[model samples]
Target: MQSQPVLLTAGPRHELPVTWQLSGHARRLVSVAVAGLLIAVITRRPEFVGLAAPALLLLLPGRGRQPDHLGIEIATPAGQVTEGSQAAVGVRISGQGAGQVRLRLHPGNWISLAGESPGEDGWFNFRFVPGRWGARQLGTLEVVIFDRWRLAACRVLTSLPPVICYPEPARLGSLVVLSKLPARLGEHTSRRPGEGVEFAGVREFVPGDRQRRINWPATTRRGTLQLNTFTAERAQTTVILMDISVDVGAAGRSSADLAVRAAAGTAAAYLAARDRVGLISYGKHLRWIAPAAGRRQAERISYLIAAGAGPPYPLEMLGSLAGDILPPGALVIVFSPLLTLRLIESLRALRERGFAAVVVDVLTAQPGTGHGRYRATADLARRIWRMEQEAIRFSLREIGIPVVHWDGQSALDEPLAPFTRRQVVSR
Candidate 1:
């Protein structure tokens, strides 16, 4: 027995505005024509009344009905992608009476998708470019199917899959400039010790001595011992302290975005160098991720940066950070614009605590001209801004904490060179 094939489909839903029924240009035109025809009929012009009937019919709200049911299915690539890479996302729409519907996707910024009509089903494919790395809640797809004559418009909201875009990790060499600094702990020693690569001591070769570390010439000459020694490689912990304070003027760039990128870049570099990495973000509230090693730590930090914005919790929060955020004995790298007094105080406090704190200032190089009724006011503001920055730099230097100022215009590595040099010398 042959079986009939069943089709998978959805019904059309209506989203027409109530006023669309009798309160538009069409309605106005109908009222005018009806009045004119009634006047003619009173004037004994019966033929004119018949002519008006046709016009009245045209003015009546058209019989376009909303779709009975509607559904939108979105398709996207699995997992997260590095920044700048493109991902494919498709939306499939199905419903009865969807043929003449006009559909639009919301949040056109996040994903780039085009709308299409595939017979009874409407489909769209999007090429998404994630501006920054993190989990993004791409809101629902909005389908607006209107009645005939465009009088009434019906809207359908369908949930779409959420997408996460991970921050792009910079290459090792690109971030090596930052790593030129000596490891905070376990640095290689110049002189060889017991169980090391360099030749530390040569005694008569013990029976159990491995041939690999044996000095044959020494063994022959001394008739006693030969062995090589090497120092053990040490690992250090790097804590990236990001200032998310709204007061930190990023100039044109968003303070939050700049902080996130800096944290990501710095953390990735530390992890790649076999150093443990930790993150602490302070703004209105504090967010901390304990120090750890490996790719997973980097991922965890990236997720935090991506998902975070503005003040941490309380909206009215202000000032710099409290002392409880950082792990003891970790090298703290603070990335901030240093625009506020509170932030400066916080950095100073960290340095006081014996933490090797380095400040990466993300301030603007060019302060553009301001517009206002008072040129004097603009000039004063500029002067105040410059003075504040200089004071912050001076304060940090006095405390022996190096401040590497990064003007958003140039590569971070160049400005970081001096700090790296200092770190090497200090180590």
Candidate 2:
């Protein structure tokens, strides 16, 4: 692999000076010499002095050579990659040193390295695969150079730059149809009749009815002018609202992670259908991307999902979203754990604003009581929490919103399958 000209930074690398130290082989030989000399003097034996003579001669620094300058460059894979994919990293060491160069890599979280050993030409090439999404560190790397006589060596250590990994999208066979669709060209069939390929029904032709749309069979049977009508193919604006306020469950299977994965999948599916899709992430702060239709929009939403982290603040309600944040008549699909009361109020507010919504409950785990003196208190709290969660679901249903549960074990589209037939309506 050709090495790029970027240098690795341990920290403030330019400001610090490189230092050299005795190699392990040299240190061991010196220790042996010292011990042998001390034992010979204590036992008054001249044979011990002979044993230390070879060690002392080998430790002589006359033949040791030091490089005038040492440098390192690493070439990492450019651009963003999806999770569970492999990328190559190249390490190149250069300088004037008549010695053996060695490289060592320490893998970091979510990253695994392969073929860590260097080649005969002293270039360390490694292939790494990221296991999870988000910005993750590649690892810490160390390069060691030993002198020709193996007396002294110099070591350079630095950390590799972080790589951005996008989550692997889940498979979604179909999307939930919205109650209302925007007046724009798209792939979905709308209830409104207009110029489209799918035939809706036949109606009596009026004065301005086009001749090409006239239904010959219906016109002959009715003995009057008749024309075929078709449903208008219009796109609907879909906004994916992610409630990242609180995350539950284990690391990869956390509610926040599942929400992100669902967001990516849903965005991809809608974008493929030529529907305008947007994203709204509400935690301590509100972040949103305006609705847009294209492959580039899918990438933008994926990047945001991977990098966005909601900040913490005091609990408060998100009363209503502005028109720009959520376009008029847009279908709002919320991915949340439903743990915060403030978020529940926001869903209610969405209904009041005349927006249709579907909520996918991403909470995978429930609270449990452990065996202890305070088990009674713990059990009571657990029951109350469960009751509160149930109440939230029931309240959403009463307000004309559908709450579907996803445990992360089933396909994301499974919970959403019901909405495909029954559209989410605003009351």
Best by TM-score: 2
lDDT of 2 by residue, 143-253 (tens): 787887778887878787777788877778788877567789988888889888999999999998899999999999999988999999888899998888798888888
TM-score of each: 0.68, 0.87
Kindly report which residue stretches of model 2 are placed more than 4 angstroms away from their true locations once superposed.
1-17, 60-62, 114-123, 206-212, 309-317
Q: By TM-score, how accurate is candidate 1?
A: 0.68
Runs in model 1 deviating more than 4 A are: 1-69, 72-78, 81-90, 97-99, 106-122, 126-142, 146-153, 156-209, 215-226, 247-252, 309-325, 365-373, 376-381, 419-427
Q: Lowest-lDDT window of 10 residues in candidate 1?
A: 1-10
In candidate 2 the C-alpha lDDT for residue 8 amounts to 23
| lDDT tens per residue, model 1, 1-427 | 2222212222233232222233355666677678869878789877777767776777565665555556556666555655556655556655635344555556535554423334333545544455556567655667665555654455666655566666554322332222223334444332324343444455556688677887788878877667655543445667887786753344225555566667777888778776778887776667777788888987788777666532354412222234434555567877887765776776766677666777887754446676777777878898998887788798898987778766544556776766554332222
Question: What is residue 90's positional error in candidate 2, in angstroms?
Answer: 3.0
Model 1 clashing-pair count: 18
